[model samples]
Target: MKKFLKVMLVCVMVLFAFTLVFGTSKKDEKEGIVIGFSNASVSNSWRVFMVANYEHEVTLHPEIAASYYTDADDKPEKQIADVDDLLVKGIDVLIISPAVQDAVNPAVEKAFDMGIPVIVFDRKVTTDKYTTFIETSNYEMGKAQGEWLAKELNGKGKIVAFSGVAGSGPAEDRWKGAQDAFSKYPGIEILGQQYTDWSPPKAKGVMEAFIQQFSQIDGIWADSGLMSWPALEALKEAGRPLVPSTGEQLNAYAKFVVKNNLRGFIYPFPAWMSRIAVQYAIKAAQGEKLPKYIEIPVDPIGPDEIADYVQMDKSDFWWVGDDQMPEEFLPSFD
Candidate 1:
């Protein structure tokens, strides 16, 4: 009886060891990749949505192991330090959503030098040192927005443009694009162009000042969805003609598009492609290879198509109905 009991105990131990090895191997397979993520601070709604998007869809995948850093409030220096730290950790891939355009270039170049794959989302650096830049064509988007404005105004209007955060690539490109498009229309005149700092509050103040100065302001283009909302709010406060506008990723703008059927396009522009960043980082972690430029396309979301494509957010197309993610995929922030 004693020998039989001992044999039974040995059999149980053997089974336990087998189970442990199997579990470990499965875990190892799941944990095969690692990524380093550096993000700008989420002080505003746009960034908030971006961070939340990362947490929900990308990070939740077991195959993707991610180390994240935040440069709160768009601080360039902090972001650079975070990238260096990620490099020190030997992360397979580097993902950056810059706080500012040019300020974040050195860190990107450093990543390039280190032989790690780099993916920049949302905004672009002045230099082409990184691998795979996934950004919307801000210039072309601006051009389209400007063209829409000109046609809507019947080629004649006193327009005040709200240029978002100075020196940022989008700011320069979109502004140039808008101006370029407007230049084609001989009748439409841009009376004032103000630096909005991409802050809604600042844009509101600028809008107020523009309202007080310009007797008849017909068209105002705020490049960002956030800035656009504040501009409209200021115009409403001043009782301006509830003019048409454009934006990206702003729900309020979408609601307005639905309510008034505004003339606008949606740029699911990877404006800080928190999701794509995770994807590329994951690819690096999985040891899969990619190219230096994963150029993404920018789509125009006309107001009429909002209701139809509100669900089923196809990843290839960035925006749906002025909001970034499809309404179907919007995870609860709660």
Candidate 2:
């Protein structure tokens, strides 16, 4: 009986040691890599689709144990705080879409300094302390749109420009590119420019004000459909003819262009780029090397190609470039 009791004591000690070793391993296995996503805002339909894409992609990666996300509601300060909060949550990788170019740089740099892999997408930060940047060329998009408008107007027209949220990377870069393009044509006269905040109501109001202020508005240079569609409506309401305009790859914009036979240029800033960002984040977490920048190519849709891209069946909020997304994730009018 004494020998048996001694044997039992030894077995208990071994079992406890086993639990401390393999049990911890099991817990770690259960909680796989964690990811943190700091989103700027879902203020527009494009951003809404982008966020949905990110969420759906996370589910596809079983190795991702958990993901934490925060929306800054378009505030750079809030975005900075959100990133800090995500970092404190012990995420293995950080993915951020900054609210503005310059204001969110410090937070991103801090994450990099902590040896955390950072993936910046859509918008960009001024600092180079990130793992990778995933984006299409906003500058090219703007330049193409401006050149198209110039050709349509025979390099001479009184044009009003509409841009997205001020100080944001895309907005600023695209504006700069468009200005550069317009500068090439000495005949192109810019009557006025306004930041539309990518809101249809606000765009409509701005367009209405432009109509009231400008006596000869010949062309409209809108960075995206968010403003172009509403601006068109404003023109119609004021009994003005629809002018040649530039917009992005939005289903509603395509449909409106096709239905109205309006001459327009559609350039895509694909929402699916968010999915690619997630792919890069997972790769970085798994100790794989990734390029510092991945530039997705974009092709502009001209008047001849507009009908092929228009999705009359889909909701107006649908972004046409989200074709790669799962059907369930696509926006619906119903």
Candidate 3:
């Protein structure tokens, strides 16, 4: 009788384990959550990384369905329409990186009113309507740039500053943070400041004009990495020495630093933006509350920090983890 009782207990445990495995099977469940992602554009490297990371999370969870919309070319109208389209699908959650803060408000507010949870990543809209905002500390990044520039120049040089797309929060905060840190040095002269509208073409024109206007331009600071690439080209074409510029365009700018044009660089927290947004959305969907402001940490792209970013000495892009590539493989993002 005792032996029979032991056999019965073993059978009971086996049955319970089978039940657990069957209950957790996603193929058997069709009523899982759907998430909608609306992006400004994936034309740039950083945005591509953001989209890839989000897609990775969706891929790992077969129970979740994701719909993606890209407002090609950073057009606000396109973004708004895209968001409306996603809303019509009745997504359980919405993820957005606005084309620009103020212009994308109506669509964001619409999603909030519908009782859909909204997660803002990287770029932000100006309303508390978003359930959470996950992005880098832009102000701190600018301050690091300021300190680096001051040290590079020995606390004295004439600087020409490039502003990107005026009134955007990141651009404005970067500018303010840099100014606040650099103002401590009285010898640093800011010859001029102007907006590039965050375009390479505009930056080219701005750089040419700066060179024409100021002969003694010793240092330059850019608020946009997208802007700096063209500016760097213009400087090379005009036979002017390149100075270190700060911006989120760290990948392209890092090549210049490695080759010696940029004395210091600031890398934006874009790739991390995706991991964070995915984690936040997953938590919120599971009934967890998040912080109102989720500021991501970032490091200035100094030579010393290169190893932490690249991980592999041979690897090319910061987004590509060392684990993704075999150690023997060549590391070239190109």
Displacement of the residue 111 alpha carbon in candidate 1, Å = 1.7
lDDT of 2 by residue, 130-201 (tens): 999999988888989999999999999999999999999899889998999999999999999999888888
The worst-scoring run of ten residues by lDDT in candidate 2 lies at 1-10
lDDT over C-alpha atoms for residue 297 of model 1: 73
List per-prediction Cα lDDT, in the order shown: 0.67, 0.84, 0.66
Write out the backbone clash pairs for model 2.
Answer: none
Clashes of each: 3, 0, 0
User: What does the lDDT come to for candidate 1?
Assistant: 0.67
Per-prediction TM-score to the true structure, in the order listed: 0.78, 0.90, 0.78
Best-first order by lDDT: 2, 1, 3
User: Which stretches of candidate 3 lie above 4 Å from their native place?
Assistant: 1-30, 303-334
Residue 113 lDDT (model 3): 87
The Cα error of candidate 2 at residue 93, in Å, is 0.7
Which should have the higher lDDT, number 1 or number 3? 1
Per-residue lDDT of model 3, residues 1-109, tens digit only: 2243234334433433443344335323545566677877654445544555655455556445444444434788888898888777667788888777788889899
